[model samples]
Target: YHLAREKKGMSLRPPYRQPHHLASAISLIGGGTYPKPGEISLAHRGVLFLDELGEFSRKTLDMLRQPMESGEVTISRVKQTVTYPSSFTLIAATNPCPCGYYGSRERYCTCTPRQVTDYQLKVSGPILDRLDFVLSLKSSGLQEKAASETSAEIRHRIGCVRSLQHERYGSHSLNATVSYQQLERTAGFSEVQLQRIGIVCFEQKWSNRTQVKLLRLARTIADLQGSETMTDSAIQEAIEWRKLPNVLQGGEHLGPT
Candidate 1:
């Protein structure tokens, strides 16, 4: 029984696991009388998408922090100890509030301020800090437009960018995973841009981790534009993209300086 799992293993062609919001800690993190791999491990070298992110228990979510940072999860039992690779890309989606209509122009929010605060706080600060960027999206009706770049063309452009990054930081390195010092040395931020970032960070009271993430995002934006050096527009765009609404503590708006 379960022979296919035992022999062939759970690696799909680019494995993608979307665990339900009701998934238990044991199911997601892999723990039982006899321990085995979990969704994070099953998604190795692939993706772990958490939809309706706020619906998961905070404890279950926090359990992801260690494995996410270490790229592996260790389970120790009386009979055996197991380590599983968990190097999967994490993509989570959540609503702006409990009723999911907060800030919507077409619909009025049904949630009270306290309820909204509680819902937003489900995803804790540590998780937010670890995230590279947070984007808030609003639904819009589709309209006719001119032809844009095809998927093939976009892929080719991305491939070229990857090659450029590889040349800069060896075969295995990309802007997201590179060390701070290495990136900073060649990030190409001018003196004025650096000073502006410093001032903004101070004003916003951003954590050291957040500041570094901003730089990494800016660096990638520059790379995407085929720019050898970071530009003011790139830095500003990164700032806007990375701006986290102050929802954790119940703020009604985001004044992303």
Candidate 2:
């Protein structure tokens, strides 16, 4: 409804919802005797929520890469090729491990190292890299409760930040949604900062795509803070977010972004 209002007169981009039970590349790609359209294609200009993300077949999940990267899904038959829009926000969730207690402090992991590896391996590196944000949630006990901002307060702040982004980009979207060229112009990083990022990328064997993603995330952090400049701290925070999965796998430090 919001998108329709925003894009008046434009074709309605119907949101696609594919349950976890329909976990198959064929299902996603519309494979059958008379193959139809796919979920990714159907989810154009909307959201694709994949619950129990790790349980999805590796091949099925792998099929997401092309559409995610290219923003279109192509289905080829004997006679013709059909293309569909796939510009959608991909949201997913999964357990930390097979036992769902890999990093839990209150509970012990019942799964073996092999089991953990197998589970992690289900979500491929390429797919993981495509994700813009990777957040880890740990259960907080009641004793840890303290005075914190409410959802309304958080939403208000978000609205302010979004307004700032709109003024900056001349659009009602975020830096994350901006193109690489736009990013290069608006979120330009300093030589020193780029050098620092280069050092980490080289050491960690991070791909160029990941490096750009880190910069984009850092830009968003800066925008949220109402900062005209992307400070070193903001860049560091973005880098840390990108490094979180590694930290979960036993890497140390994992300092502030």
Candidate 3:
């Protein structure tokens, strides 16, 4: 795909790939007689925005699991094997339900409980677990606009936080990418805070992977606030951001986290 765009100009910026929802597994991931790089590989060091994420086939979506963990995708053909960098930040957007009004404050959800469950589960648990933030946003209807930080200001703040993380880890590693041992050592949570986290994890029945991600997220929240110590408030905020939308189980909302 990129080879076809080479004549345009050499771009120093990282590539961004946003394949359509109907893209097949072989197209989204690479496959050919000579095995070319796909959208994921082309998105290396940049963004892979999967709009209407649930519309994608499960097989194609699950194929991302390995590359997401290993920071690269491997394509093996009859003649040879090839690997391509795929350490891209994935951003996906989808509806709360089939009718897109499951938990809306305005519109009533027309979807049945079963329908909602099935639709939400289109993106599997393992994939959701790999994500750092999972937020449910409401439409900002024609309300009065409020003052907010400018893009440049927000970018500056993010840059500072990133610099801090790089300095702390002695590398380019951010909170989300640091080694678990390194993160735990510098997490800076109080004993009481740790106990609270333990209680929440048990109550939520969160996987070990989720628990690690929660800490990483909390660490980042703390860093963003210019706090050397991870506070209870940071942990709480992280928990809220990490919670999955109300998914039905046995005809009742499990309040998944």
Candidate 4:
């Protein structure tokens, strides 16, 4: 038995498909014989999570570069092409190595350097650059109870930010979509703040896109503090958050320089 129904709201994708074959790519980004919307379209205006991101093919992952930047995907067919909205927040997770343990205090990574590089390369540089935030989480290494945040508490904070965004921008205009002009008009930064941000951007040798992403992130951090003005602290925090991992920086083995 089967029922046809539309599923709406945020989507969290579970890992699927080995090597992310051409069929898998088509299934996700669309362009099969029928030319239907893919998972990206299905997750429009929501979250599209790839739990085991590295398992997908480098070619398949590269296909996401355009959509993440444009927030839309165009599928070309022999006679017709279809464009689908893919404006979804991407959330990805992957192991540091094929063995699912790299740089872990608890377990040694058994994969060779080549193996590790191959695994990491599955997600291309262009795609990684498109990601707004790329963080590497390590084990907490605590057996006893430690202070932590509940999902509800985190959700409350997010809700507060959403309300603030809606109030400031009028009608839930997210900071992610807001232009530099809009951000400047809404949360204007002072001369001192701009100087500090400029110094950090120059020292870090960050790209123009990274600089823009930092501004957007800083604006969000300011909103989180219920502030109308962007502050140096907010900009610093955003810069810290965008720091690339050692592996991502020079594409070297995980060893001391």
Candidate 5:
């Protein structure tokens, strides 16, 4: 009721999506003919925050791929296939490695290269690709820093941007949720911008899906900056965010400090 009232005359609040730890699923298979439910369904309406994301089992995490894309979950029994709504915003956080110190200036990583590879491999490519955003959170090391801005201020900005998108798209979706056709029409990128993206795509060997995702992210960045124009800075940041996983796979590289 509250969500509907807040988003009056529109769709429900997008659900929050989070992943569960692998160890939590160990007791899921009790000696029974009927299968038990999982954590994904419970994270239906609000934030599904996955902490220490890489520790989850690959198979367990892989189960989320379809639902993440389709916004519905299906469980098949001998009698029938049941479906549930799974449209939720995913928010996940993870340390750089198992030792929790890979690429950290404050501490050294004790895990071997093989261990790091295995840990990272637990998170599949398709699953990672489904995530709309990936932000690396770092601690500022000071507890009593002056408050920069309250949530109200941030939400006000988001609301303004949201209103603009609603007026433009005539839908409840945000700029991030704009379709490819809408993006092509509404997001005006210059020839130079396209060329730069083309070069990056070719050089990085980005997939078609990734290319689309990059454009969408760039659009969002532009919106946040209150720029009607999609500048090189916006595109560059989007590309950097998308490329972090690939670079991390190769080896740690300098990022925002």
Candidate 6:
């Protein structure tokens, strides 16, 4: 924070931690007789990758709920309580099912309907609700016909948006971290817009927290284009995040935009 505030260049080293198969709840969520920081804390202000996401133990994965929502993980030990920052951009990859062939165009899924259902249940509904965006991607193994934009190019664009947000908020407060009243006022949601959101919440059975998340996503969408006021299209784009087939299958598939 000091380096950034002073306009000095901090090294671009973001932590990337992956706790794959055989990873325990204690390892992922941080817990022991003597509490210690876990993968989430290591990945703070960075990315945490969960590979073979569906194969993870349900109970262990569920432990992510609190930290994913609050940006901090608390481990209560016999002697003390340890709290660690876990504000991370979570990235997960996995097959559509346990057999690793559920949606594959080439391989047929051998798992039965009930098996697929049970396998996906490892990621619960509440966990799915906590995710910001979801994308249903087709399998692609072939080389790209066109060259895609590099990560550096994307980062430069995101940096411009971050600068705008910093200027507006007078700090590094993200759209996700801003208070509701500030969001409503700064984003300038009109009565009609408010009604649209309300109707979505009702139709989708979204909780108040989910409603706030949608608002934040809308704010970020507008911010990406340097728009002071959130637009209807931004809200619609945010709404589509939850409607993806991956989300419908109870997977938290949010990735950095």
Global lDDT of each candidate? 0.78, 0.73, 0.78, 0.71, 0.67, 0.76
lDDT of 4 by residue, 42-106 (tens): 66776676767767888888888888889999988888988888787777777777787766667
Q: Candidate 1 — worst ten consecutive residues by lDDT sum? A: 248-257
Model 2, 1-257: lDDT tens digits are 23112233445655856566456786665545455556665567777778777778888888888888888877787877666677777877778676788867677889998998898788888888888767676666699977698989988998888788788789865776778887777776888998998898888898999888888888888877778887999988988888776655411111111
CA error at residue 152 for candidate 2, angstroms: 3.8
Clash counts for the predictions, in order: 0, 2, 0, 0, 4, 0
Off by over 4 Å in 3: 1-8, 247-257
Q: When superposed on Cα atoms, how far off is each prediction in RMSD?
A: 4.2, 5.4, 4.0, 5.5, 6.0, 4.9
TM for candidate 3 is 0.87
Give me the overall lDDT of model 6.
0.76
In candidate 2, list every pair of residues with a backbone clash. 236-257, 237-257
Minimum summed lDDT over a 10-residue window in model 5 is located at 26-35
Model 1, 124-144: lDDT tens digits are 888777787766766656785
User: Comparing 3 and 5 by TM-score, which wins?
Assistant: 3
Which regions in candidate 1 have their CA more than 4 angstroms from the true location? 1-12, 142-147, 247-257
TM-score versus the correct structure, for each prediction: 0.85, 0.81, 0.87, 0.82, 0.79, 0.87
On a 0 to 100 scale, what is the lDDT of residue 223 in model 5? 84
* Model 2 alpha-carbon miss at residue 118, Å: 0.8
